[model samples]
Target: MEGERAGMKIGINTWAWVAPLTDEELARLAPRIKAWGFDAVELPIQAPGDWDPTVAAELLAGLDLAPAVCAGLLPEHDLLADDEQVVRLTEDFVRHCLRAASQVGADVVAGPLYAPAGRTWLLDADARRATTARLVDRLRPLAAEAAERGVTIALEPLNRFETSLLNTVEQALEVVDGIDGLGLALDTFHLNIEERDLPAAIRTAGDRLAHVQVCGNDRGVPGGDHLDWRAMLAALADIDYAGQLSIESFTAPALAVPMSVWRPLATGPDALAVEGLAFLRGLSAVPSAKNSRS
Candidate 1:
């Protein structure tokens, strides 16, 4: 499968062209995604029943495209909310995501699982400690449940603008520490904004890294920005990360108002996916060349 996929298992998130990916959209995009040489498709679980897992499993199995799930946490689904009902609802939603991932043959459910995107609050030293304790209490059971379902909960650290809970690798590691089924999901976009050294952060994730999201610094096609892709990929190799590097840009209409992605990331979302895939393929060839010479 690695050879057939041109070295690494590259994927594109459905969010690149649509939000809350629908049954109709998945049917439309799955074939084109496979045709574009993506080895996998990342299905974003925005709401339960936005898309059917059984149908998606059948569709993706037929096309031979691997499936992955990205948990989309809305404002109403905050695990750390003061409202107990909100927290309960969040846990229920995540469990649904786990079941959905298992049904769709996805091993990892990746996203900002601690809080909703764009949810920020002042965290003083004492508050930070309290928050970490709260997070562990909230996530420990979910991690156990994920293990039962054969799915890993990959907790992603968003940028400061998007979140205040876990904005760095160290902070994220702290939250998931000692948890059996929890792992880190890193993104180049957030890394570019928050990390002092990109490759170092990737190395820091090491074996706990369950998933990776890649895109240009400006949220365009990767390799179209100034990020050092080769160095980052080398760090992944250093850590022996053999997983998918998913392209995760968003379409203007879907996330422009909130994400500030008013300008076109590429000629179109399709161009962004195709160009990012080509660039990643070129990078994957580098190690092959070195090995051939050796």
Candidate 2:
């Protein structure tokens, strides 16, 4: 991973192309993604039949591109609910996704797997505590299920606007405290909103950090916004984070409602991915002075 892509696996999520992606679409998209110099592509499995993992596996393999997965936890799929049936159905969904991830040869399935995106409600202190406990109880078995398939369920925490449940790295760490096969998927777009100190929060995630997503603070391409890429890159290096840094963003007309991505974020989706890739690849390209320069 050192030539054009250095010290990191730069990737783009298929959300940059289309949501609820289809095998037909990926069949056309995967090869172009490889030509763009992305080491991996973050495929989203929105539902059971949205795409076929085996088809995706063969397509990605033919192009020599690695594959990773992100799952959309829709409103109905609730692992943190007080109701047992909701939890049961949610666990089944997660297990199905883990199997899909394995079939696609993804080492981890990453996303805000705890609750549905953009679905939030207020919870008082007692309720919050109870909910977290319930979540841990529900997800422990799912974590084991993931391990059995040789994949990890990388839990992502969204902003308060999207989810009040686990908004910060500290909170995500607390929920995954005793879980054996669980990890965190840190996305810079959400971190820009909730975290006061991005670098410190990344360090706090430390080893439990399994995956990373990079984008502008405004959800534009990375390096085109005000985020401190220098410090963020340094922190990731300090923690020895080896997971793929997928460029996650949504296009218009497709995810406008769920993601609120109405306008065009860049000239086009490919432009965003290309610019971000160049910026990220340059993160460790230029070495600082005084290493042995005295």
Candidate 3:
């Protein structure tokens, strides 16, 4: 408490509500999200007008809640595609999302920002380096675009099955090397699958950790599964990561197929989100090696 960031805003992704999000859905969910003690809400940006930033911003402002952007880069929007058209389209989509993020008062446009989710392939050492080089080239001009919009593009590392590239913090850091206005979005679910030492990885990310998405290791409620939340919270405090800890689980129909959600992650999305909030709010009350000193 003495050393942690004074206020750590908690958020729930509208993925918990719906995917291919609509303006109507966001309008309806924002108030309820605000009522649930969330200081912020993360909206999924699928296209230029999928959800109007100006409208969402106004609604959140009325609710006294902050907004954050999560760029929905489906398989169709692959930045690392071999097809030139796909690559160009993906770049445009990212630029569009960056503008939307700016309009919605969010400084970070966050997502994998690479190939489609759940697509994996093998790559040799040379091919891996070449692919990384290609991503850096593609992202360079977009980084400039992001900077213009006062946005930082946070590259998230999905699990190995979801992606073959940038599945670890080290890999993501290398990809964003020499690129300004770019950072890493660490999802604890992915880290649970990929990192040997999750807290060490978080510490290693340190300042480059632009955004954090939290969930249970089993993709359930945060405290309902096996994750070292205490250590993770302390690592966040150590880095002074002044960003919202957004819960990023998916709903049953819209994202369940793609995200591999076979059954209910909770009684419902609201219960899952509410329970996680209670656990995090109680973090400071429980002393551990990570937070006892604080």
Clash pairs, candidate 1, are none
Compose the digit string of candidate 1's lDDT tens values, residues 39-70.
99999998899999999999999999989999
Compared with the true structure, all predictions reach lDDT values of 0.87, 0.84, 0.83
- Per-residue CA lDDT of candidate 3, range 1-294, in tens? 311353568888988878778889988888888887888888887667888888887888899888889875766788887899998888888988888899889989889887777778899999999999989988989998898888899999988888898899999999776678899999999999999999899988978888889999988888888797877877777677788899888864678887789989989988987897787776763343445565
Candidates in order, TM-scores: namely: 0.94, 0.93, 0.94
Q: Which is better, 1 or 2, measured by lDDT?
A: 1
Best by lDDT: 1
In Å, residue 57's CA in model 3 sits off its true spot by 1.0
Worst 10 residues of 1 by lDDT: 284-293
Superior candidate under TM-score, 1 versus 2: 1
Stretches of model 1 off by over 4 angstroms after superposition: 1-7, 284-294
Candidate 3: residue 63 Cα off by (Å): 1.4
Which digits, one per residue and each the tens of the lDDT, describe model 2 over residues 1-294?
A: 122222567789989878779988898888888998889999898889899999888888888888889996877988777788988888888988998999999988998887888778999999889888888888888898888888888889898998989999998998876677799999999999999999899989988988899899879888889998877766776666778899998863578777877677888888988898888877654322222254
